[model samples]
Target: MTGFDPDWWCDGAALRGREYLSISRDGVELARAELDPQSTDVDEYTGLDLPATVVKIEFFEVRKQLRGRGVGRWAVAALIQHYEGPWFTVAAVTAAGFWTSIGWTEARHAARPCSSTARYLFNANALPSLDHGSDL
Candidate 1:
């Protein structure tokens, strides 16, 4: 049941603020997620007012063979447990449904302008209580 862990300082000592999580198995890299602790892209893209402390899953991808094997869900869940505050991501059109299935909700902001892309938010208060190994 061993899963991924966030190598918070993967970018090295000098670039500590820019963090990335490497998901691996037996030393093989399976996936990686770029984390932005102070991302304002949510506001810039959707006009939603999110706190500066919110962790944005800026970029996430798994190897093609790893898809549908629950790796993505585990990575996200691990991140939620590792980080504090809210979580959010501007999901690509193709991946919006997956995000929703995993407990993320479409964040609606009155000021949000009409856009072709979808924005999702995982408010800490609204998160479902899930066990570490539970299927998301």
Candidate 2:
């Protein structure tokens, strides 16, 4: 079990003054789960035997003032495009319903009982080979 950091909302000075690009127009931070490049955690989660890197997107929240403008969708799309892994996986909690509404299939249901609700895994495979300098 993992917890979302509260300081994630802090753009600068809080996170060592590091810059986090906002996926939304109002600069709301996008929650991102970065995987180990060596694929150490892939075997433990995804059933796929192949070693692959993944990034999990848990939530997409826009300010109440900026709701219903499709900004959240745009942010998620940008994140999916920016992620350059051989495979991508997400353990969507709050957004599981929304993920299913799109093309993401629920890989696991009631995967964890210790928690209050079930867990879901959504995955997508990337191209076999992508150019280093070009966008895939």
Candidate 3:
């Protein structure tokens, strides 16, 4: 189960427009992602303000038992189908490859070694431009 951190999620910006979509089976929440109408800052790397019409896929996670079962893909596809917005974005660290393989392009930024987290961005309008092949 994914931990709910409303404080970390709402350190800044308005959360009223955010909608969370969950994928569950047999009473288990295997995967989930948030549909945020207002996108956060990309360049500055701070959770503040909307980045235009970008629908940010915030806080996505798939359970370990459900990994590699394609359930994650199905969940994302469902979200895409239901989403009315034109563009979507997501920021991932370890799961960047998985998202890229599903056709979400990377919004490149200078590699900052400040923390163990590796940030990646994806757009809905174009196929993902992966710097490396899918291995994760």
lDDT of model 1, residue 10: 35
Best by TM-score: 1
Error of 3 at 135 (Å): 27
lDDT of 3 by residue, 2-85 (tens): 443444345446367788666776788767666676665445334323245566777776666668988778677656656634
Residue 132's C-alpha lDDT in candidate 1?
A: 43
**Candidate 3 ranges beyond 4 A from true positions:** 1-15, 25-28, 40-51, 109-136
lDDT of 1 by residue, 48-115 (tens): 55666667776677766678988778778777766755655645556888788888877654565565
Q: Give Cα distance to truth, residue 129, candidate 2, Å.
A: 13
Cα misplacement distance, residue 21 of candidate 2 (Å): 3.5
Candidate 2 lDDT over 54-102, as tens digits, reads 5544334554455466555555555556655445455555656765655
Give me the candidate number with maximum lDDT. Answer: 1
Using all chains and alpha carbons, the TM-scores for the candidates as numbered come to 0.68, 0.51, 0.59
Of the two candidates 1 and 2, the one with more favorable TM-score, higher being better, is: 1
